[model samples]
Structure formats: C-alpha cells, structure tokens
Target: MSPTTLPDGATLRTARPGDEPGILHLIHALAVYEREPDAVENTTDALTRSLFGPDPQVFTHIVERGGEIVGIAMWFVTYSTWTGRHGIWLEDLFVDEAQRGRGYGRALIAALAALCVERDYSRLEWTVLDWNAPSIAFYRSLGAIPMDEWTTQRLTGTELETLAATADGGGRDV
Candidate 1:
C-alpha cells in the first residue's frame, strides 16, 4: 500500500472497511499503552461490526506513516443537556510508541476539533486516566480544561441489563 503523506509524512484519513485489522491492532496498542493489556476483550469481529455494521454508531480516523497504520482516533457524538447541543466524545486516541514523538496526536485531536467546529458541535470531550501526566499535558496544551466539578458514572455488565429491565415503574426483574 502506498503511504499517504501528511505534511510531516503522517497521514490522517477516515478508516475504510479494509482497515478492520489495522484498527484492531491500534486498539490493542492503546490497551497496552493504558496499562490494561489484558482488558481488551473486544474482538476484531466486534470492532468490524460496530464500526461498519448496517447502523454504524462510531467513526474512526487512522493515522498512517510509511504506508502503515500507526495510530487511531475513534469518536462518537453525544448530547450534552447543559449545552443543549451535540458534542464529540472521543472514545479512544492512540499512537504507536515509535510514532509518539511525531505530531500524530495533535493531528488527530485537531481533526476532531475541526470537525466539531465545522459541524457546530457545542463541545469536544474525552477522558484521560488521572495518572497519565503526558496525556494530561497534551490536552492542556490544546486548551482543554478538566471538568473537575463533575464525576463520571457508568453502569455496565449485568448492572446495565438489570437497570434496563426495570427502568419503567420497577418491573418484575427489579
């Protein structure tokens, strides 16, 4: 595959159906970077379906260098009640260790932010592990502020199913 070149030889482009394997690889790399290598329970099949299924819910951009995928940024839109507008939620942003010093991270974030501006999204948000200093610095450099006033809550696994089953008037499942 001929490498598409960005200004510094780092090309950023929307992922294609043929890039499933590359995307999975980048996801694994990201898991490793986050110190949760064993937490990547997702399969290529799951990723393939999630991104390109009949009803696609996520979008991704792959960063290529020398004709090889070196990084990825996956994102989706969410509604913010306070802003009353659609916002971009960056699900994952990962760059290979070898490619870290380059401008891929900045490129990816800029691309997402530009998309938000062009599409009139009220905000762009993503989370970083509290201990990830380098990432925190990068985000800060881009003028992102920590939402210290709010905390993230999640319901997953059996809890999610149980909650859904009893959402309306406390069903029998509750």
Candidate 2:
C-alpha cells in the first residue's frame, strides 16, 4: 500500500524490501535508547529474511519526513484464547532522537491502531519498561493501562531448547 500522510506531514507505510537498513538503524538506536546498545545481536540480513522472506513472520511500518525515515514500528499478530481473536503485538516503536517530540511516535501508533480498527483486531498492545517514565507517561496519556497483574515470562536460548527436548520424554511434567 502507498504511504499515508499524517497530520504532521510525515508519511507512514508498510516497509518495502529496501527498508532493512533503515529498520536496523532504528532497532540499534532503540537499543541505545533502552540502555542496551550492546545487547543488539540482530543483523540486517537476518532482519531482511525475517521481514521480507517468502514466509515473513513479522511486519514493519515506517514513517518518513522530508524523505528521511524518522520512525518505525515492527509488530506481529497474536491470538488470544480468551478473546478468540487476534491482536496486534507491537514489538517495537521508536522515533529517531532528532525526530522525537514531533509526534512521530504517536503517528506510528495511530497507524497501527487504524489497522486494528480496520481488521477487527481485538486489541493493540505492547510492553514498556518500568524505568521508562517518559514512555509510560506517553502511553498513559493515550489511555493505555498498565498490565500490572500480569507478569511476562520468556524462554529463549538454551532454556527453550531444553524445553523442546523434553517432548522426547513423553512431554510429561516431572
């Protein structure tokens, strides 16, 4: 689809094949913003394959202003057994440091929200670090409530592999 114009004059659109570099740049920049610059292990080639491969698992939307990419939102859909509907899970949303405070972040979120409304997605959701006061405030201003009762747990690296291996033992609990 063609990029849509935002109130701020920035344009938002689904990322094209050549947007990997810009997407990776923002990914690393966001790592720095989250105080984990050294934790980013994703390469552009991996990102390219993940987003543009034959069976892409994720989608990204980018916002441009004056011909330069200023923000990006990478997301995927998740099914909720309780709601019996798919919801958009925003993995990351970031605006370049120089372009922040210009409503680019809000524009990116609004674009995703529009997609939710169009697709009958049950919800639009994402996680924010507790230490990120600015981001928390911004989300609150948009009427997003904190999921304080829920604790997020993740299994990755060796732990995930170990769990999968357990299936060989009849997948039984100890």
Candidate 3:
C-alpha cells in the first residue's frame, strides 16, 4: 500500500526493516500505558524475526513524524470458520502521549480497516481493557461495538508448558 499523509504531516505506512527499534519502543510504551510496564519481554531481534522473517506471520503499520515513530498498529491475520475467510486481529495500537488528539490513532485503525476491506476480510477486531474509559469512548465514536458475550482466555508460562506436556503428540514429532 502507498504511504498516507496525515493532516498533521505525519506519514503512515507499513513497517520495514530497521523499524524494529521504533516499533519495540512503542510496544514498551503501550505496556506502560496498560499498567504492565514489566510485562513486555519483546526485543528488537524478536520483532525482526517475527515481522521480517522469511515466513512472516505478523505485520505492523507505523506513523512517523519528523523522522521519529509516533504511533503504531501491529496486527495479524485470523481465520473464521463461520465466514470462511481471514480477518485482522489488531494486537496493539498506540500513539505517543504527546501526539494524542492529532488523529494518529484513528488513522492507524482506519488503515487496518482499509486493509480488511481490500482483502475481503471478515472483520477488524481488538480488545480494550475495561478500565480504559478514554479508549473505549474513542472506539465507540468510531462505531465499534462490544463483544459482550465473549470472554478472552489464555494459558501461559508453566500452565502452557504443562498443557503441551499432556498432549499425546499423536505419534508425530512435537
């Protein structure tokens, strides 16, 4: 996709090589904003491998201003059996605290929505912390609805490892 020029002169475009550091920085900042500063274990090298590796499974869009990254939308594709098509799962969306209210966040999300339409994807979805009232209001203004009936579940660390150990492997290599 071609780079888009935002109203504030920031350029929004897909991330490329050498953008790992900036992207990781935004991710760290996002963690802090989410009140989980110590939860991020991501590294620039890991990002390079996941986003720029031979078989990339994830992608990112960045907003850059004055040669510095000020916002990012990191996402991946998901398949829905009901739709029989793929959709986008937005993993992260963040703009620098100082850069808020300039429409950077909206631009990033709109870009992802555009991608969804262009690819015939089923939907564009992400989760917001319930306590993030500001973000919830912003999303509501953009016409997003809550998936009230669904609850997110996850297993990590020892729990994840223990579950894997319980798998029989079905006589195949794990």
Candidate 4:
C-alpha cells in the first residue's frame, strides 16, 4: 500500500526495519491506556524478531509526524474454519493521547480495512475494554458490531502449562 498523508503532514505507512523502538513505545502507551501500565513485557528485541525477522507472522502500521511515531496498528493473520479464509486480528491500536481527535486512530484502522479489502481477507477484528466508552462509540460510528454472543476465553501461565502437559505427544515440539 502507498503511504498516506494525514491532515497535519503525518505519514501513515507500514512499519519497517528501524521502527521497533517506536512501535514498542506505542505498545507501552497502549498498555497504560488500558489501565495495565505494568502489564507490558514487550521489548524492542522481541518486536524486531517478531515483526522484522524472516518468516514474520505479525505486522504493524504506524503514523509518523516529524519523524516520531505517534500511532500504531499491530496485527496478525488468523484463520476462520467457518469462513475458510484468513482474517486480520488487530492486537493493538493506539494513538498518542496528545494526538487523539486528530484522525490518527481512524486512519490507522482504515488502513487495515483497506488491506483487508485488497487482500480479500474476511474480517478485521479486535477487542476493546468494556468500560472504554469513547473507543466503543468510535468503533460503532465506523459500523463495527459487537459479537455479543461470544465470550473470549484464555488459559495462561500455570493453567496453560498444565494443559500442554496433557498433549498426546507429551508436549513434544512439533
């Protein structure tokens, strides 16, 4: 996709080799905004490996203004058995608090939607904190509907380890 020029001369484009630090910063900011400031354990090295490494499965798009990254949309592909196609799972979307209301957030999401359309992806999806009213309203304004019938579930830490220990191959590497 071509780089997009934002209202204030900011450029929205895909993340590149030297973008890890900036992307990681936005990730930490996102964690803080989600009221989980201490939850982020991401490092630039990990991001570099995941986003720039050979066979990278994850991707990120960022907004840069005056050479500083001000927004990000980090995502990965997911397969839906029902649809028989791959879709984008937006893991994070964030714009600097000072840059909010400047259309950066919308631009980031719109870019993902454009990518979905371009690649014939079936969906672009993400979860928002239930109490984040402003974000909920923004998403709704963009015609996003909630999958209210579905409940997200997870098994982490000790539970995840316990479950893995029960695998048929005794959790041997595939």
| TM-score to native of every candidate shown | 0.90, 0.94, 0.96, 0.94
* Predicted candidate 4 versus true structure: per-residue lDDT over 1-174, tens digit per residue: 778898789999999999999998889899889999999888999999999898899999999999999999999999889989889999999999988998999999999999989989999999998999999999999999999888899999999989888786656554
Better of 1 and 4 by lDDT: 4
Which pairs of residues collide in model 3? none
Error of 1 at 81 (Å): 2.5
lDDT of 4: 0.92
Candidate 4, residue 142: the lDDT equals 95
**Angstrom error at residue 66, model 4:** 0.9
All candidates: CA RMSD (Å): 3.1, 1.4, 2.9, 2.9
| Cα TM-score of candidate 3 | 0.96
Q: Please report the candidate that would top lDDT against the real structure.
A: 3
Where model 4 places Cα greater than 4 Å from the true spot, the runs are 169-174
- Candidate 1 local lDDT, 35-91, one digit each (tens): 898888878788888888999899898898877889899999999898888989999
Ranked candidates (lDDT, high to low): 3, 4, 2, 1
**Of models 1 and 3, which has the larger lDDT?**
3
Residue 57, model 2: lDDT of 88
Preferred candidate (TM-score higher): 3 or 4: 3
- Total clashes for model 4: 0
| Global fold similarity of model 4 (TM-score) | 0.94
lDDT of each: 0.86, 0.90, 0.95, 0.92
TM-score for candidate 1, please give it.
Answer: 0.90
